[model samples]
Target: MSNESGHTEKLGIDDCTVPETSVSVYEALYRRRMAWDFRNQPVPRDALDRMLATAVWAPNHRLTEPWRFFIIEKGSAASEKVAGLAYDFALQRSGGEQRAAATRDSLLKTPVLIYAYSTPGRDEEGTKENYASVCCAAHNMALAGVAEGLAVTWETGGPTRHPDLAEALGAEADWTLTTMLSVGYPAENPRSERTPVANFVRWLD
Candidate 1:
């Protein structure tokens, strides 16, 4: 199949088989939620890899796939080191030992932490495109995780803004920290509210 962009692709007949489920794409869209409370159970490595594989397929202008992910496995030395840095960063930012400790504990308990970074393009417009593409990739990962029966949340707060954290993640000078995704099994289903599309969308006929 080919679209207006003239990109041709072929799919195997076997690949067209859909799983027997009532969940449609729209259902998946509505069902996916940001999860806060997570279980200590680990997400399988193959499942995580599947999520990432789906993530990289997100549309990008000029095929500039600038997204890069750093996976910090739970209970690993790298995870501990990253958690320590995060704790220090949180303490410095909030000036609360208790809060920092809580944050550290959460990081330690989470099964996977995927740090996303984007390498800037040649010009300002190109850089913006790269950033947007990275956001789409993150969204892809989140939705894919949801489909795999995992809880997922994207965080772009302290770590994304911290220079030390970026350095620790080995991001280059031109690369920008985009997001950090926490993926694991849910401890509980947290309800979320979203404003209707009518509130933000405008129809032009």
Candidate 2:
């Protein structure tokens, strides 16, 4: 009936519009891309605070609110461990040291690593829905990061599944990392490209 004091809203990810004059919702989504290149500059603590403020607005089913965050600050000891794990994950997945080095550097280049976790304890359908919600929450965080003058990516195949790594990030036994965000300033502007929206949409009316 009511909202979380100040967080409740009807705006959903599917309800954004292009920013022709201002940074419209559609424009933000359209402009959003997985940032692979991040500048060495540090993200301000206040700015990250704002990003987290916006991230919790994402929609969830039953308000289970299974979302929890693990912030790996760039210079922190925990952040260094994840960086090493990322390098190992890259080597194992890509089968080479070049890629592993790149992954290690990529994780270390950014100033913040916001690990997104989901608490799972239900059937397949519930698990699927909760993940969907988690992803939506991450998207909001990414866009919020951009809007706050930063770049972010939802990394799904990094070192999240490593039980030891997750424990290092202070996750519970049941909470799994669905995504990790390496966020910072743009080292270089990304090339613009995307699949046409019409290819993925249809008018039913």
RMSD of each: 5.2, 5.6
Worst 10 residues of 1 by lDDT: 12-21
Off by over 4 Å in 1: 1-22
lDDT of 1: 0.82
Tens-place lDDT per residue, model 2, 40-129, is 788988778767756667788877777888887787888778888878777777799998897777777678889988888477777777
Best by lDDT: 1
The Cα error of candidate 2 at residue 18, in Å, is 20
- Residue-pair clashes per prediction, in order, are 0, 3
Cα lDDT computed for each candidate against the true fold: 0.82, 0.76
Angstrom error of the Cα, residue 102, model 2: value is 2.8
Q: Give the TM-score of candidate 1.
A: 0.87
Candidate 1 lDDT tens digits, 129-170 = 999999999888887777788878888876456557877877
